[model samples]
Target: MTREEREQLLARYTTGELTPLERERLFTEAMNDQELFEHLFEDDALEEALSDPAVRRHIMNTAPAPAPAWPLRWRWPVLAGLAASLVLAVILIQRQLTPSSDRSDEHTSELPSPCLLLSPL
Candidate 1:
């Protein structure tokens, strides 16, 4: 075949457009012709196939699923709740530590205990 015809056949093979017979013929010829083998080797067919969206989708579907993001979506809220709880705990601790001097003994002595109030008569 002329150089142009040879190049056209290579191009068809690159695009995966060749019949099984054509593919067999090309491979058989390539096995004997170092120059033709070099031409096919240099072609960017594998790159083109990998870049195709269908190939990418197939790879994605077959690959293991990535770790779930269920915790990530709740991370902010959980952190916020933890922070709020920490602050509330700190405030309660401070309240318990600092004794209030506002009307302690005098006011407490006037009120009856809840246990006596709630007891059966």
Candidate 2:
């Protein structure tokens, strides 16, 4: 392979995109070429740096922050959904905690009878 072809192959190898046959051919060529061997070493070092969790984390931390998943225009709807969910949860909890009434008189006492209210008028 020419110098340019070797470099392209090296890139493919570094990115793990090379087939087994191509990898074998590259290594075979590297054994006879000092420059290709040095390129392989450099690629190995780069791969190691990329694979290390601490190095990856450092890279990620230094990178620019990504845009929010929900844009500003969508914020109100998201908040409204969250508020509705919270309200529903509170209502369900309140209903669950409140003791069920079996007494008819206790329930009747809360609302005025229509007939009694009409008689007074």
Candidate 3:
């Protein structure tokens, strides 16, 4: 790959955003190119302060850590499903509680229409 492409791949690889194949290509290119290997740390303090004990110790300590394992991968999905079900249930209950026109007959017995009340008056 060209220098620009390699740089992009290197960035992605460093950030853990590269695909497996892209990571393979990046490592292969870095191995083949001594200058590129040096260039990877060209701007970082690792190149200038690498000889210092403190710097070396910090580098060893601060190396990128592994990804943390999740306890349950389906936890988020389960919660989302539960939230959706709750919302749906709330909507259904609200619709049921709000009297519909179809049930007007039942309401008319207790709360007569104004026209019906006025007819007697």
lDDT accuracy of residue 30 in candidate 1? 88
Q: Which runs in model 3 stand beyond 4 Å of their true positions?
A: 39-121
After superposition on all CA atoms, what RMSD does each candidate show versus the true structure? 14.5, 12.3, 14.7
Model 2, residue pairs in steric clash = none
Ranking by TM-score: 2, 1, 3
Winner by lDDT: 2
Per-residue lDDT value at 26 in model 2: 98
Per-residue C-alpha lDDT of model 2 across residues 59-121, encoded as one tens digit per residue: 989999889887999889999999999999999999888866755568888887686445544
Ranking by lDDT: 2, 1, 3
**TM-score of model 2 (CA atoms):** 0.41
Name model 1 segments beyond 4 Å from true.
Answer: 48-121
In the predicted model 3, the residue pairs found to clash are none
Q: What tens digits encode model 1's per-residue C-alpha lDDT throughout 1-121? A: 6667677789899888999988888888888889898777767666778789999889789999789867688989999999999999999999888877765777888898776446666
Give Cα-based local distance difference scores for all models: 0.83, 0.89, 0.79
